[model samples]
Target: MRTISHGISKIEKGISILLMFSMAIVVTLAVAFRYVLQSPLSWAGEISVFLLIWISFIGGSLGLKYKSQAAVTIVVEYIPENIKRMVMIVGHICMLLFLFILIYYSFTWILSPSVSYQKSTTLLVPMWIPYMAVPLGLTFAAVHLLSNLFDIFQKGESQ
Candidate 1:
């Protein structure tokens, strides 16, 4: 379980780092070209936009793995430690369920023939190519949530 959690965290971090760096490069080149050279790459914007989507979804999972999702922690701060842990476990369970549903529906949408026919306006790439990031990221987040829940359960036992 520890190994799985660690591996998922590493994978999430690696993809996130790559996406952020690539987005910076893509946006920088797009800006430099449009302003400096007076010619913009049509594909650049589309690629960057899609990359942003991927970044956002992947970052969401990373946030869950790190337990950094912003909520009014004030509410839980005063609660008893064990109770707080249970509350957070429930929260993680909710996150897992939501991600599962999203992945299921998004996957179906991705595989639909209509989706296959749709293409990005500028890049003309199949829309599913960009859409796939949603399920992939959500699935990773789901796995991380499960792993974290396991950790929390064991934590309660040790305490």
Candidate 2:
């Protein structure tokens, strides 16, 4: 299980990094073309937006795996060790529930006829392609959350 989780984490990180680099390059080229060459690439803006969407979603999953998301840890720090563990487990469970709900609705929204038929104005790509980031990212986050909850349980058992 850890091996699979680690593999997924590595893939998510790689995709996030790639999307970030691609977004940077696209924006740079867009700027150079519009300002320096006096020719604008209409699709560049749309492509960059798509890349950013993917990056934001995938990066969010990475944050879950690393427990890097922002939190008010002051109160948590003062809690007893066992209480803290309970709190962590409960927190992760709540997050997983939220992610699952979002994932369900996101998929429903993506599969609707209107959304399915729609396409980006500049890129002419299916709108669902970009909108899909929501569910996919949330699914990855759910996996990470489960892994984290498992770790918490394992630690509690060992102690």
Candidate 3:
């Protein structure tokens, strides 16, 4: 289980790095075209927007895996140990539910004919391609949540 989790983490990190690099390249080209050539790349804005969507979704999933999502822990810390455990369990369950909903809707959204029918006005790429990141990220987050829940149960059993 540890190995599987580690592998997923590594893959997520690698994809994130690639997305960052792609965004950097797009920004560089956009700037060069607008300033150096005195003409903006018409497609740059559309491409950047699409890349931003992908980055945001994937980054969110990575955050879940790392438990890096922003949260105020002071309230939880003040709670009694047993209550805190219950709160943690409930929170994880909520996250799992949220992820599952996201995955389902995102998949349906991506599969809708409207997605394939539309193209970016400037980039001329199918909208579905960028929209795919939604389901992909949600799936990753759901997997991480389930894994964490399993770990929690295992620890409880041991105690």
Candidate 4:
């Protein structure tokens, strides 16, 4: 399970890095063209927005893998170990369920007739291309959550 999680995390990280690099280049070109040449790129803004969405989602999944997400551990700190483990498991389960729900609806939304025929104003690409980040990111998060839950069950409160 850890190996699978690691593989997924690796792929997500690689994708995020590439997207970040592309975003930087696109923004730089946009700025250079707008300020220096006085001719703005019509698609730059839209592409940048798409890149940012992907980066945010992928980075969020990485956060789950690294356990770097924001948490209010103040109350948890004083709790008994067994109860704390239970709380953690329950929290992860809740998050997993929520992710699954989001994944299901996102796919439905992406495949709907309205969205299926839609395209971005500047890029003319299918709208679902951008919307895909949601379900994909949520799915990655779900995997990480399951991996964590597995670790908890196997290791017994070591987390």
Best by lDDT: 4
Q: Candidate 3: global Cα-lDDT?
A: 0.84
Q: Number of clashes in every candidate structure?
A: 0, 0, 0, 0
TM-score of each: 0.92, 0.96, 0.92, 0.96
TM-score of 3: 0.92
lDDT of 2 by residue, 71-139 (tens): 889999999999999999898888888888999999999999999999999878999999999988888
Q: Give the Cα error of residue 148 in candidate 4, in Å.
A: 0.6
lDDT of each: 0.88, 0.90, 0.84, 0.92
Q: What ranking of all candidate models by lDDT puts the best one first?
A: 4, 2, 1, 3
Question: Which of the two candidates, 2 or 3, achieves a greater TM-score against the reference?
Answer: 2
Runs in model 3 deviating more than 4 A are none
**lDDT digits (tens) for residues 1-159 of candidate 3:** 555666777888898898889889989999999999999988888888888888898888778777899999999999997787788899999988887887888898999888879897876888888889889888887877777777777777787
Of 3 and 4, the candidate ranking higher by lDDT: 4
Candidate 1 lDDT, 1-159, residue by residue in tens: 668767988987888899999999999999999999999988998899899999899898888778898778987899999889989888888877888999899999999999999999987899998999988888888887888899989989998
What value of lDDT does candidate 2 attain over all alpha carbons? 0.90
- Report residue 83 deviation for candidate 3 (angstroms): 2.0
Candidate 4 error regions (>4 Å): 157-159
Clashing pairs in model 1, backbone N/Cα/C closer than 3 A:
none
Query: Where in model 1 is the C-alpha error above 4 Å?
Result: none
Where is model 4 poorest over a 10-residue stretch in terms of lDDT? 150-159
